[model samples]
Target: MWNTLVSIFPYAIAYTIPMLMTSLGGLYSERSGVTNLGLEGLMLVGYFASAITIKMTEATLGINALPVGLLVGVAAGAIFSLLHAFASINLRADQVISGTAINMLAAALTVYLARTISGSGNVRIMMGIIRKNVPFLSKIPIIGPLFFSQSYWTTWVCLIIWALSWILLYKTSFGLRLRACGEHPSAVASAGINVHKMRYFGVTMSGALAGLGGSVILITYSGEFNGTVAGLGFLSIAALIFGQWKPLGILGATFFFGIATTIANVSQVIPSLQVIPPVFFKIFPYVATLLALVLFSKNSAAPKAIGEPF
Candidate 1:
């Protein structure tokens, strides 16, 4: 049992960080009155660009490639998101339609770009990966083994970002204004705050964090960009809603879903659960997601102007 837990729990943590980060991304956009359904596409852009960067620069940078690659992914996601920002925010286009276009474009564009640049089908990054144990913390009892050992630096980075996001969204003055924009943009504008600017910041931040989340998935777990994020971005959106759009709630929601995500493989590894059909395990996570939404959606209270064009 101990060995089984060791194997599964670390992976659960790995999966949780991406969802947590991306859900936080959605939180920012929705909080500022922009409905961002293009997180999937933005994440694809980040994942592809980061993986390609690591692959292309492997020889020159050696051990330094992934850190640099992360920045490239963030930049790519932000740049690509400009189209959605312009269409939804400036052109006053339907936010859902604009986001849908972004998702479609990201899927095709990443694959095409990857094939063209790498001279092959998929983009893979497999150089100088970092998986390290936290120093003194790893020396603790059972807690250390579960949380601190066999982890990536990326996990720590995401945790820090999570805490910072909470502070930014709840504790700061700008946070109040940003939240107010979602509830009442006209009131915010009347108060002399630039509603448009806040919304822009919110949308761009969503792209940036979602992109970072995608890169995290690649570097920590997948190590390859196959022109798809495997629906993790959509899952993040679910988590955002599941968390009730709150930062701490997002943390808990992602952690729960992350465990659900790994159930298929973990059950196979465990002797007790191997009797179930493998197909059931494969479909369990998504089914669980839908059920969770059904149970929770009626009670959810999203921002008043989340899908509205300001």
Candidate 2:
């Protein structure tokens, strides 16, 4: 049992980081009164953008290309999210429909572009971020081994981003205004704040972070872009709801789902886990999400004006 736990812990953390970042992105959008259901598509766009960029630059730039690819991915997602921002904020289109359209368009467009450029629907990269120990930190006892050993640098980067996001959203006046936009745009607008601009910032942040999440998957575990994120985007949305739209809550929720997913993926190889059917593990996260939603819906802290066009 100990060995199994130790072996899977790192993988769970890796899986959780991406979802954590993406869910945090959702928090910003929802807090600013925009419901960004297109997180999955935004992530895919980032994933593909990173893949193509890394594929083209790796040979000439070596490992440096990895960071470059990540930047490209972030930029792509931010730019792509403008489509949603325009439709939902300016044109006042139904946010849900616009987000769904983003998903469909991303799935189709990425694959088509991949096939055209590479003659294959998948784009593979030759190198990725290497895992390393945290030196003295890895020397700690129980906590050290589980958290610090064999970790990716991207994990720390994401965590830093998460920490900063919390401070930004909770401690800053700008964050207060953004949150106000979600809860009562009229009130914010009366105060002379640009509700539309704040909402646009929120949506753009979602796209950027979701893109980062997707690229993290590519550079960490997946190392390729195959035109899909295996529904992780929707799962991130679930995490957002499960976490009650808070950064700390998002961390815990995404980690729980990450562990469940890791268990599902590795269940076949672990003797104790194998006793339980793999399907059980596979569906556990989604089931838990549904249960969380049902249990928390009445008391949900979702913005009062969320999904409402300002």
Give the TM-scores of the predictions, in the order they appear.
0.94, 0.99
Determine the backbone clash count of candidate 2. 0
Task: Determine which window of 10 residues in candidate 2 has minimal summed lDDT.
Answer: 281-290
Tens-digit lDDT track of model 2 for 1-310:
8788889999999999989988998999999999999999999999999999999999999999999999999999999999999999999999999999999999999999999999989999999999999999999988888999999999999999999999999999998999999999999999999999999999999999999999999999999899899999999999998888889999999999999999999999888888888888778878887898888887878889999997
Question: How large is the C-alpha RMSD of every model relative to the true structure?
Answer: 1.8, 0.8
**For all candidates, what are the clash counts?**
0, 0
- TM-score of candidate 1 relative to the true fold: 0.94
How would you encode candidate 1's per-residue C-alpha lDDT over 67-171 as one tens digit per residue? 899989888888888888889889999999999999999999989988889877688776645678889998898888889988999899889988998888899
In candidate 2, list every pair of residues with a backbone clash. none
In Å, residue 63's CA in model 2 sits off its true spot by: 0.5
Instruction: Give the Å shift of residue 249 in candidate 1.
Output: 1.2
